[model samples]
Target chain A: MMHHHLILRVVTKMLVGTIILFAFYVQFHGDFSPGGGFQAGVIMAVAFILYGIVFGLNKAEEVFPPWLVHKLAAFGVLVYAGTGVVSLLLGYNFLDYNAFNPGHPSHGQHWGIFAVELGVGITVTGVMVAIYYAFAGRPPPINDEDW
Target chain B: MVETIINIILFTMLVLTALAIVRIDSLFAAVMLSGVFSLLSALLFVTLDAVDVAFTEAAVGAGISTVLMLMTIALTSRTQKKATRSGMVPFVVVAVTGGALFYGTLDMPNLGDPNAPAQLHVAPEYLAGSIKDIDVPNVVTSVLASYRGYDTLGETAVVFTAGIGVLLLLSGLGRRRRKDEEGDA
Candidate 1:
């Protein structure tokens, strides 16, 4: 097999950085731009996958530890679900924006929406990263003699 | 006119990339092509003005899924050295099923029609009332989180399921053995 080149390494790093920044841009600018939580998560996942392909699976795993990714993914869902539960506890229906804040319905809604979107972003990004590590880390098959 | 042209180009690229995914013998190349398919689909979503769906597709389809696939490929097989021969019956069945699905889609609304029934329904209410109803600038977010929060919750659950599935699928006896060794040391 051909060894990975330095240029490929630099390009991969650049691409990864670019993807992350773009994800953030997409996440925050969802109100105006053509992106939101899903786009950002996918972008980050792609970046990591690129990193794995160009650098090495071990290095990619090192950068994004699997345990941490699992936690983040779980946390993302918690955040989203928690938002609804919070609204429900506040005396409104599940995910009722009016209940987010007692008096300021619109403000509460805004905050709630932002929080949920952030949750979506977190969960998706983590799950994707975890998947990448799992797949890329598969051991090469053993030979018949080794078996 | 320019937007329409760009959409056409993106659609073409998406088709080409998808075809490449099938044709490429190398598993890695196939995975990469799949990512390109996701990227192009994201572009198509943007063109169709379904930003929220586009965002989700970008993250799940292109980002996390691609990496996971690569990891799976690594664990299972690196290269497609041997071209396995398959019977034609299965291929014919799959082709016929796919063709029927394709034909079914023909009756759907034209892509990105602002005045379609879909646009006229709950979407219009969200677009118009979001400012007054939820007071959010982005109707998409408002609809997703506030009006239709159940759907968003379900989506999150799906993400959680996927994470759990990955952990379960990839973890095995050797992995546990390593953990045990580390713990003992």
Candidate 2:
């Protein structure tokens, strides 16, 4: 596998960085654009998946260990639920952003949306990469030439 | 006139791609064609002024799903098996389902009708109030992340559950257990 095509490796190296940068741009600029947490997360995962394909699953796992990925998935849900719980404790309805800033409700709404979207982005990136790992980690039943 | 031409061309391509997918026995070609189908629909969505939906369809449908399908093919088989019997029963079932769906669409409101029930309902308030309440330029973002936060949270949970299910099914838990037992011995 290490002796695989150099051109593929070089192209993947150049593309991976650009892909991750675009993912972040999509994640943050989503407030003003067509993308959001879901699109950004998938793009982020694609970076890792492409790396896994070109380098090898073991090398990709070294960069983003599986245990960390699992924890990140759970952590995203916790972050989202925690935002709602905070608003509830502040004497507002569940997920009421105004509770965060009583003097300036719209500001609070902005902050709340940002937090929740960030949580969504993290969870999506985690789950996508996890699924890819699950599929690619398996030993292929047939040889490559068989395809 | 331009919009109509674009719509017709995109839909024509979509139908042709779908037919090609059906005709091909090679699963790899089918997967690639399905990605093309997704891209065509994304273009259609863009023409309808639904940029967000188009972005999602292109990313998920054309990008990730294609990769996933390719991985699945690697795990399974490249070619589809030939049917041993006539396709009459499946054809009848598909025809009946398609007819029922088409019949259901007859009651749908016409596209872009301002007075349609869907447009008249919560949409008006969302459009009017989003800027004042959320101060966000993108109403869709404000609605998804702020006003309808609970629904988005539910969707995230659903994604989480699906990931856990796949991990349990395909992560080779039994193989790890056997390795642990061997170390103990």
What would the per-residue lDDT of candidate 1 be over residues A75-135, giving only the tens digit for each residue? 9999988888888888888877678676877888778877888898899888877766665
In order, the first chain's TM-score in every candidate is 0.85, 0.94
- lDDT (0 to 1) per candidate: 0.77, 0.91
Chain A, model 1: TM: 0.85
Task: Write down the TM-score of every candidate.
Answer: 0.78, 0.97
RMSD of each: 4.7, 1.2
Interface Cα RMSD for candidate 2? 0.9
lDDT of 2 by residue, A1-147 (tens): 555569999999999999999999988988888888888988999999999988989999999999999899888888999999999999999999999999999999988988888889899999999999999899978675565
DockQ each: 0.52, 0.86
- Distance (Å) between predicted and true CA of B126, model 2? 0.5
Q: Find the candidate with the highest TM-score and give its number.
A: 2
| Model 2 misplaced stretches (Cα beyond 4 Å) | A145-147
The 10-residue segment of model 1 chain B with minimum total lDDT is B69-78
Q: In model 2, what are the clashing residue pairs, if there are any?
A: none
Which ranges in model 1 have alpha carbons more than 4 Å from their true place? A1-5, A8-22, A44-65, A140-147, B1-16, B51-64, B78-87, B112-116, B173-185
Model 2, span B85-135: residue lDDT tens: 999999999999999999998999988889999999899999998988888
